[model samples]
Each structure stands twice: as structure tokens, then as C-alpha cells.
Target: MSMGKKILIIGPSWVGDMVMAQSLFILLKQQDPDNQIDVLAPAWSRPLLARMPQVRQAVDMPVGHGSLMWSARRQIGRALKAEGYDQAILLPNSFKSALIPLFAGIPVRTGWKGEFRYGLVNDIRLLDEARYPLMVQRFDALAYPAGAPLPEKLPVPDLHAEAARVPQLRAQFGLDGTQKILALCPGAEFGPAKRWPERHYAAVAAHKLAQGWQVWLLGSEKDRAVAENIIAALPQAQRQRCHNLAGVTKLEDAIDLLSVCDAVVSNDSGLMHISAALNRPLVVVYGSTSPGFTPPLNEQVAILSIPVDCGPCFQRECPLGHMKCLNDLLPEQVISALEKLVPGHEQAVL
Candidate 1:
């Protein structure tokens, strides 16, 4: 039993990756209740870290992702030395990600052997994709000794939302709590390749609205245009019932608001992971990416992806000049998946 061992985690920069990292935090707490877990991530992830009970605190990483700010890394690492973190876990497989922990002089630095991070991480493990197929599994493996068998039942990421704030957020957004809410996440930060067609999203929104459900489009400021396009495609009556909340609410507000949603239809983006963590019924549409690697870590999720010969290409955009993978995926498929995921919704209006 490692008692009172403080651990520091170099978290991933992407939103979905940060959410999935909670599984590792849960495993650390399970291993020893006295373990103090702190995350070093981007400034934006503070709100996310607040939702995870296992995290003691979130230290903002001063350097931007992929930036080789040697002096900044050294300063941050030296500053954390007094806290005396027993171990530092590196979530990103980048050489730069290991620099801070190494400079901090943490005794045990653990991570996968990525990008010549040989001496940077003292307790490095070679990743076996088959053994740890899911991203959650890879994160959890860092908590245990090398070659140790993982627990049969791994803990899933469950973010805690403030029920009290739900109503306040709804009021702030002028949302009606009387109707069943269907949250639509139509943007993917990775790029357009991962995003489902906006017309498809409008179709789902229209169908749900006709069935007496309110639609809420959720995303960051970058997604506002896409949200508007979805609304523009809908009839005025249906658009009246659809609320475009993208770029309006803070991430924390979105988190609390999403908790109140009956179901969520999203691309394989960060909000999809957030919705899953909130335990909402989720239908994730995958285009360029495949769910075989990083599926939403929730039982209530229905993954929709078309098998295209050019697909699972994992590119930022379509290489063949056509996004047939997402374009070919009909809205009816997503609606049917939603009906199966959440009962009582009317059949998709073609």
C-alpha cells in the first residue's frame, strides 16, 4: 500500500482525451485512497478537472501544446518540486510532454515509449494496442506495475454535474425545461472529416422537434457557424423549437446543461465524450475515425460509422476530395440509432 503518495499527471491537450483520463485517476484512487492526484493540463481544462472528484487540483500547464518552451517547462517543473509528487504519469506520447516531469526530478516517470522518450520516462512501457485496445485501458495501465493484469472491470469516466445549476443555466439560455431535450453536437474540432453533415443534423433536429422534443445545438465558438447552418436548413416552426447555444455558454455551463438532456446526438468529438461521461443516452456518429479505438466510454452509446474503403483514414480532411463516409451516412441511420438508444422517439421523418 503506497500511502500518501502524491501523483502528478501530464494530461492530454484534447478535450476528449482529458475526459478519458479520468479512468486513470479513478484507478489511482482505487489503488490507494490516500493518494493525492493532481493534473497538469491546459487552462481550459480547469472546469473539466473540477467535475472529477479524484482530482485534488488542476495545475495549468504554462506552455502550449507542441511548443518546446524549455525555460517555461523547467520553471514549472522546478516550482512543483516542493509539492514532492511521488510519480508523474505522461498521457501524451510526445517527447515534449515528458520534459516537465523529468525536469521536476520526479522519481518515477511513467509513459509509453513514444518519440525517443527513453530516459525521459524511467518507468516506460511499450504499448500493445491489442492488450489495451481502448484509450481508457492505456491510461489505466499507467497506475499499475508493468505486466500486471488490469482489473476485469475498469472504472468509466463519470463527471459530476451540479443539479442545482441546471435550472439556472436553462434560464440563462432561455431554454424550456418542460419539453424533453435532445442535444445536438454537430462540430468536430479535429476537422471537417470527423464532422457529420450539418443537413443530417438538421434532419434529426427537425424529426425530434416534430415529436415534441426540444433541440439544443452545443459546441464552442468555432461551431456556431455549423449550428446556424443546421438551423437554417430547418423550417421556421422547427427552428423556433431548436436553440442554438453554441459559443454562448461556458464549458461548465454546457456540462451542467447537458446533464439535463434526455439524449444527445453528436459527432465523435469532445462533447460526445462529455455527454457519455454525464451518463446521457448518446448516439455518436463517426466519419473518418473508427470507434474500434476510442469509442465513447459509456454503455448507453450507439456508435454510427460507415465502412468506406478510404475511411478510418484518420486524416484531418478527406484525401479523395469527397467525404463519402459521412455524406453517405443518412440521417435516418442516426435517428434509428437514437430511437434504439432512447425509447419513445417517433420514427425519423424522411
Candidate 2:
């Protein structure tokens, strides 16, 4: 609403972070119902933004991740200058991410201090990691005055799926809308350290498949091989019910399809956050990463992790060459978590 402050948000590059950013958007709206929020992020993230009703629009940031394309950012900034944004909240702490708002000459630029973004972000806050242990807390903190205490209950990310298109997508993917479905997100784009073993995933898939639940593997194109491996481990009958939607469905399509899933078991991946936002029952297996930082924010979710001394290493690939954390977090833990999220013993048509 032009009646309130026209705020421009420099959104995060990763899908999970972008989804979590919705909490900040919600807080901004709660603070001022008429606050207009527009996000500048990667083109791929537009689909995620579309589902967050709080966002007025999605502004494409043409620069690729890690690229300091000053000319490109300046061009986009010059174009947005006409919009007259009152404030800019940056989810990313990078110095380059603060450039556009500065270029646009937005009066008040807000973000945490990083890469020595001293003058570029006029309203920067020095982060206190001890105070804000959670990543979501850090994002939410930017909405308030620096050093202000956050609300006791921070809003979780909630994405509105295109429910009307569910049937069409189901038909497109040969999914029966009434069938009991279990969705699995087996890939962690961060790297192998965050991923649970494929065989462990297969073990869980077998548990659900035996209980007459169909399994749908969801991830980006990079995850196709792992999805195939999960499917391969199942018997012919169970394999028929296990569908590899990885690398096939678009991100939005995955969001819509996940809406119909009875439950979801996933690594700490983007799709895991999506499923949580959709309010689907979820069990997230943690490895190199820990839930203490970015736990899935949903009532119907379970956070699973077997803490190894080596982890939460937070590394992309395990430096020790042994991912004891993920490898040891057995399938039974996930299945047990699934049981708590959803009482899944009910009979389903095979």
C-alpha cells in the first residue's frame, strides 16, 4: 500500500533463507498493515515470493550469486529509484547486496553489519550472535530497532500454495489426489555432509511403501541420482508407487504437489522448508547443520539429529571424510518422527 512506507527488501539467495524471510515480511506487515514489501532476489525465487501474500512484487536481481556486477546492480537501482522506497531491509549481510539500495538513494538502508558495509547501510545493526542464536531470529531482529527485544513468539514462514491447480498438477504427475502420500527431499544443495545416506532414505521409503503409502522424491536436477537410488532399493511393487519427481517438477509445482502430501521426510533442504511452510507434517534429518540455527517452523514437524562430536560441523563436505552425524542418524529415527507427526498406520489403497 502506497499509504504506508514503500519498503524494498534485498532477499536471500537460497530458497530456504528466502522462505524464512517471510517471517520478516509478516512482522513488517504486523507492525504496519499497510507497509508495502517488495523483494529483490534471484529470478528463481520469484515463485517462492509469489506464495508470500505480503510481498507486493518480486524485483529480479540480475546479478548472479557472488558476482559484484556493479553496472547491472546500478542499472536496476536507477530503474527502481522512481518507486521512491522509504526503507530497505537486507536479509543478506554481504556488502554487494547492499549496493542496489544505496544506488537507488533510498533514505534508510537497514541490515546487519558484514563485509564492512559501514556507509552503504546507514541503518546497520551490529549482530549479537549470543542474543539471536537462530537464523530466523536474526532475520526477524532486523525488523525492529537495533537492540530492541524481539517478540516472544516470532511468526513462522507460511506459503499459500496454488490450491486450484492441485488437481491439474496431480493429473500431470499421475498422482491420485485421495491417495496417502509421503514426500521425501533427499538432497541438501549445501553438499553431501548435510545429506542422509541414500540407503537410510530407502529404508524409510520401504517402511512407508509397506504401509501402502506412495513416496514422492522432491529436489532439484542435482538430486535425480539419489532419488533414483531410493526408488531402486524398493521392490517392484513398492517401486511402482515410488515416484521420482526430482529434476522434473518446477519449484512452484513442487510446492503445489507438496500441499497434497500426507507427510514429508526430508534432509535440511529447501524443499523441507517449503513443506514446512505448506504446513505438511514433516520430519527433518539434521547432519552437518543443526536445528538450533534454522529449525523447520511448523507445528506438525519433527527435527531429527544424532549429534556427533564432529558435528554440527556446518561444513559443505565433511572435512574428516566421515559424516558420522548423518550416517548414524538411522532410518528408525525418521520413521519414529513420522509416527509422531502423523499417526500413519491407517490402511491405504495399494
- Please list the residue runs of candidate 2 whose C-alpha ends up more than 4 Å from where it truly belongs after superposition: 348-350
Candidate 1 regions exceeding 4 Å error are 345-350
Model 1, residue 109: displacement in angstroms?
Answer: 0.8
Q: What lDDT is reached at residue 62 by model 2?
A: 83
Give RMSD to native, each candidate.
1.9, 1.5
Clashes of each: 0, 0
lDDT of 2 by residue, 2-42 (tens): 47789999999998999899999999999988999999999
Number of clashing pairs, model 2?
A: 0
- Give the top-scoring candidate (lDDT): 1
